[model samples]
Target: MLNGPLLVTERLILRPPAAEDFDAFAAMCTEEETMRFIGGACSRSAAWRQWCTLAGAWHIRGFSMFSVIERSTGEWVGRLGPWEPDGWPAPEVGYGVRASFAGKGYAFEGAVAACDFAIEFLKWPQLMHCIDPANTRSQALAKRLGAANAGATRLPPPFETAPVDAWTQSADQWRQKRKEF
Candidate 1:
């Protein structure tokens, strides 16, 4: 529905996911560790459907996660960017890096670039991250990004009952903390 800019970080390329990215996306989604907080690991077939849904979101909503790629290797590393499904509590900037790529600070780096896009193009007055309460790593990232816990929220459908903590801040807040984002 819309053509947005592709983002380039220090060592990564953030672009919309395509069929060619399925293998990498599937591998990550099927990994237990990667799927830890966002529902359990999914089967390859299930992952395919999920991957398709992500791509479809871009067409339908004009926005969704972008496939993160390694600049030097040209490999899909993960998906990260803005996501707000129906019934979502608020506009959110979400991310997930492949296990092998985890710990390299790519998530943070990618998120900064993604949040920049979300604020600039999406023009969301505010931003939020619906993080799992037990996901300490994400909690740390949220804090680092300058989003305070806005409180709990219920996700839509299947996982609605799960405990999700809302981390949010106004665009002005993000602008003040924009030095790093």
Candidate 2:
């Protein structure tokens, strides 16, 4: 099942998502500010389906999104982990923090944990964090994870409305930069 409590950070716990987390995931995706850079609200059904797909990916490929939780309260802050987005050259690292939790370092905590997993566990040679140029916060987060500005790649035509720019991190690069943490 490739399932269990996988990794932990200073303030976050990375685990597989549970059914009860659907509501929080949907709400986080629907919030104005929380979702502003990622596109529009995702329907509740869509969110659950997405969550299932994330878990399914783990069984199928051995890696997928980790539901991020607050260690202190056990609250579902959001998700952070790795996935192979369609057309991406490598598994992309992505994350989202619940609206109320944004700006509180949860995203960074979860992201760093995911990056560590990608490097240490998955042993992926490369990772990407595609972002909208206007999404400075996410871009900065990518930078914090040791991803460099890799420039834009064409948005899959279906998502013509989405932004471009694929920030990339090599395993060697991550190992070097991660020492600072």
Candidate 3:
């Protein structure tokens, strides 16, 4: 198992998903608002499959999405980490916040931390954030993390449901850019 200390940020805690988190996760996955850009609400079984995939990533790839928690309530606020869609060029740092948490800086904080981990620990050469063109919130977050717009592309095979614009940043680029934040 790829174990490490809980990833902590000023207002968030990024930790492995626990079995008990299924409820919160499932709720988020099923919420219309939360799944708006995720191809609509997923079934409970689909949510479980997603959880298993994240766990598999920890064992197979050494890093996976963390259940984002708010420090104040220790609530499962959303998810943040890297994921490799069926045939993508690289693992992309992805995030999804609950509807209630959407306007907060949690997305920015969690994503930047994940990017830093990939740069400082994983030694990944580059990181990407794929978002639908209509999701200005995520696009802005990518820019905040120093990812430059790479234009629209398919979401790799299997996971391909809609076209998306890709935002990319190299480890070297992130290092330089984070300092400016």
Candidate 1 local lDDT, 77-114, one digit each (tens): 89989998888888789989889999989899898888
Evaluate model 3: give its TM-score. 0.92
lDDT of each: 0.87, 0.80, 0.83
Q: Give a tens-digit lDDT track for model 2, residues 1-181.
A: 3275568788888988777677788888778788776655677777777778887887788788888878899889988788885665457888888888989988987887888888788888887887888889998888887888888765555566676688997889888888887
Model 2 stretches with alpha carbons more than 4 Å out: 1-5
Model 3 lowest lDDT segment of ten: 1-10
Better of 1 and 3 by lDDT: 1
Off by over 4 Å in 3: 1-5
Q: Give the runs in model 1 whose Cα sits over 4 Å from its true position.
A: 1-4
Q: Identify the leading candidate in terms of TM-score.
A: 1
C-alpha-based local distance difference test score of model 2: 0.80
- TM-score, one value per model: 0.95, 0.91, 0.92
User: Rank by TM-score, descending?
Assistant: 1, 3, 2
TM-score of 2: 0.91
lDDT (10s digit) by residue, model 3, range 1-181: 3254488999998887777778888889989977877656899999999888887777777788888999999899998887775587567898998988988888898988888887788888999987888888788889989998888877765657676888998888999999986
